[model samples]
Target: MKFIYLDNASTSHPKAPGVATAIANFIEQGSYNPDRGQYSGANDTALAILDLRRRLARRFGASSPRQVIFTQNVTMSINLLLKGLFTAGDHIITTSMEHNSVMRPLNEIRAQGIRFQVVGAEKDGSILPDKIEASIDANTKAIVVTAASNVCGTVMPLREIGKIARARDLYYIIDSAQLAGVLPLKLSELEADAICFTGHKSLLGPQGTGGLILSDRLHHCRPLISGGTGSFSHSEELPGALPDRFEAGTQNLPGLIGLAAAEKWLTKQETKILKHELNLATRFISAISEIDQVRLIGRDADYCQVDNPGRIAVISLDFPDRDNADIAAALYDKYRIMTRCGLHCAPRAHKTLGTYPQGTVRFSFGWSNTVSEVEYTVSAIKDLSQR
Candidate 1:
């Protein structure tokens, strides 16, 4: 039986048109590493990588292509930034709605005297810029936050927070995993020093493809790993350039190539994709709100009905009298509707939502999901609720 995929917050499915073809073509014909060799194949690979960088730079409104630093995924990019940039006596500010990608690294770096204060989010998962500003102290070095909550889909007030960061002269880094392709983002407008993004999610690229867009201000941040960067190989020390300084080791050529294709596809379909996802989410929320036992989490259903919605299509539901895991399992087993259940690697977000330890079942919609699929999932939920 075919399954309805509603767990796109974890990873996107049916990737962009031509994504598979791009990866397959690269693997089959030209699998050379970029910037490593002088042959024609190597030169071609390097140019393709450069093209991807330029595309991403223009897509995100970065200063230049040199600021686009590729990494394995957003988690790696966040780790590199958190571990490499801050030192002893430096404090950072973040929201309680962050994924483990930010929380875990911050916890690990506490051993090195780097500290962070978490500004609490409202029960609806909304954060206030004033609260963030009030939390900043003399030792505060940066403000790191996710653009939206992966658990509840509540969009943060980034531009407001960015203004606060700018006024305070603090480095602002954003985890754009949940917001990248779903929302139109410009790093300059957000006043962000860096944006960590993952390709396998909203970008609709292959799994191992993700990177960071750094502003000129953060070009001096220390590298997390040092090795051969395919440039300045004669010297034992790592290269001191923009990307080569941060990106070390053999890159994921096929994945990046696939990402380039996905980027091209997104450039054309972004408006339609956003419209569809919003419609599906609004429809699902409207239907589910009618069930008495079923509780819709995050911002009110009305928030999604606007012309420009604040949040993505990630919907989490709480079954007050039913086990969330059991409901998720029943969804897949009986209705062939796949979903994610539990903390979703974001215990802090769950805690903020008052669902910690008993996390909600999340149904995240994506570009390929249809209105019919959402309606069917809602019907299944209604039937399960009655049982």
Candidate 2:
């Protein structure tokens, strides 16, 4: 049976053209470790890594290429920044709509006498900059928030929040796992101290590829992991450089190559792809709203605003009397329609949407999804609602 994949929020399927080919080519070329040797192959590999860094820096509007550091994934990227920057007695302000990537690390650091405050999002998953500012206190050292909600696709007011962070002299960190490729991001304009991203989601790259784009303020923060950086092998301490300071040991060369291919692909079609995905989402939401048994989460008046960024392709539906997991399973087993159900690693977000204990069924569209697929999925949901 032909499958209809709607779980792009978890990880994008059908990655950009040439992603797999790029990975295979890199591996076939004898996978040389970058910056570890002086041979031609190693030098070429190092150049490729540098090229990827520069490409990412330019694409994201960073001041310099040195600001981008590759990590295993966005999780590792966020952890590196969170653990490395904050210490005892530090305070952080974030939103309830954040994914575990932001929440879990903060919880881990709480034991070190660090504290964090969650600025609750509106019922429609929209965060107010004033709410964020109100949460700030003298001890507040940073503001960490997601660019978009993974569960509902509610895009935060990042520019306003960034301005607030700047005026308060606080670090502004953005978890852009859902927004990197689907939205236009100008880190310089956002005034973000650091933004974390993953390659497997909107970036359309292979898994195990992600990184952080940070400002010069990172020079004061410590490295999460320190070891042989290949640059300062002669020294006992970690190299006090931009990328080499955070990146330790050998890196994910093949994955980074795939990411570079994906980035190139995204740069060429960002506008068209985002419009297509958002249009599909709008159609899906309109169709699903007509079903009596379906309750759409975060689809309220605020979400319907023309300028509301919350209207990305991610949509969540709750069945008032039916189990969301059962609905998801039925969609897969009966119709070959794949989706994600439950908390989606964002229990706090579920709590904010009042879907905790029983999460909603999520359909996250991607560049490859079509209007026909959305129609089919809506038909199936409508048919199932009556049963």
Candidate 3:
């Protein structure tokens, strides 16, 4: 049987055309130090990096391209923003649907006197703007929420949350790990103070390419890493500007090149990307709902109970009689179908779903997946029920 890769929530595979080619091109023909040289190759390479940055800025609708600072991944970008903004006695407001990426760091920092309040989302995994607003106190310096749940593919109402954050003078940080490709993000309209984006997922970029977009409001946030930024070598501290200030050490030029290509490819297929993913999710939901043993999660689009209504292409099913691990293995061993089974790294979401110990079998779809692939996956699940 051909492999059915359904673990896109982990990372997207079969990257866009030219993604690898871009990486290879960068490594072979375009390799040059972005900084510390006035030679033609170095100048040309730096321009290439800047060009990618500009594209990233445009992708997120960032007001300034320089604000699109690259990092190793979305987690790194989150850490960079969280560590930089949070301080002693500062309280942050976050949603309960957050992955370990947000919770782990907040928990670690909370031990050091940094405080945080996690407002629970509704039963369908949608967080209310009012709930987030209510959690804010005088000491609350920021409100951070996942732009979409990685576990369930539920998008959140970040724009409304951003409004509340702005009204309360709190920094609004969005983890855009799952929404960057499947949904639309107009950073300026959303009032997103910062958006942590990964290139490997929706952007169809290679790994090691991700970034955070800082709004003009955060003029005082500190840098998580202090090193040579090439632009202020005379000083010992990292540069206190966008992009350059946060990006420390040498960048992954090859990854950035791939990222640029991926973003370009995504731009060419913007409408198709969203519609295709949503249609696939709808199909998965429609097909899986018909199965007696599998339970579909989330709400109907017309009756959106969550702030960000309607899930993306990730369909998580609860097989009550079967062990999640065993079911996952059966899919792989018997059908060559790959999927993730467990809490999906977001224990909070599982606890919300009341499936903490027994995580659901996650079938996350992407642009590369076809209708036939979805049909085959559904057929495999149907077959699994008999065994």
Best by TM-score: 1
Best by lDDT: 1
lDDT of 1 by residue, 276-300 (tens): 8888888988899899989988986
The regions of model 2 sitting more than 4 angstroms off are 300-308
lDDT digits (tens) for residues 1-387 of candidate 3: 689899988889888888998888878985988777989888888888888888878878887788888899999988877887777999998988999989999988887789999899887788888888778888999888998888777778888888898787788889999888766787788887888988898888988989888888875778777788778778886677767778788988888889888888888896776777777777777787788987766654333222334677776788887887888999999989899998988999988876778888998887888899889889989888757
In model 3, residue pairs whose N, Cα or C atoms come closer than 3 Å (at least 3 residues apart or on different chains), thus clashing, are: none
List clashing residue pairs in candidate 1. none
Write the candidate numbers in order of decreasing lDDT. 1, 2, 3
Sort the candidates on TM-score, descending order.
1, 2, 3
Query: Higher TM-score: candidate 2 or 3?
Result: 2
Q: Of models 1 and 3, which has the larger TM-score?
A: 1
- Each prediction's TM-score against the native? 0.98, 0.97, 0.96
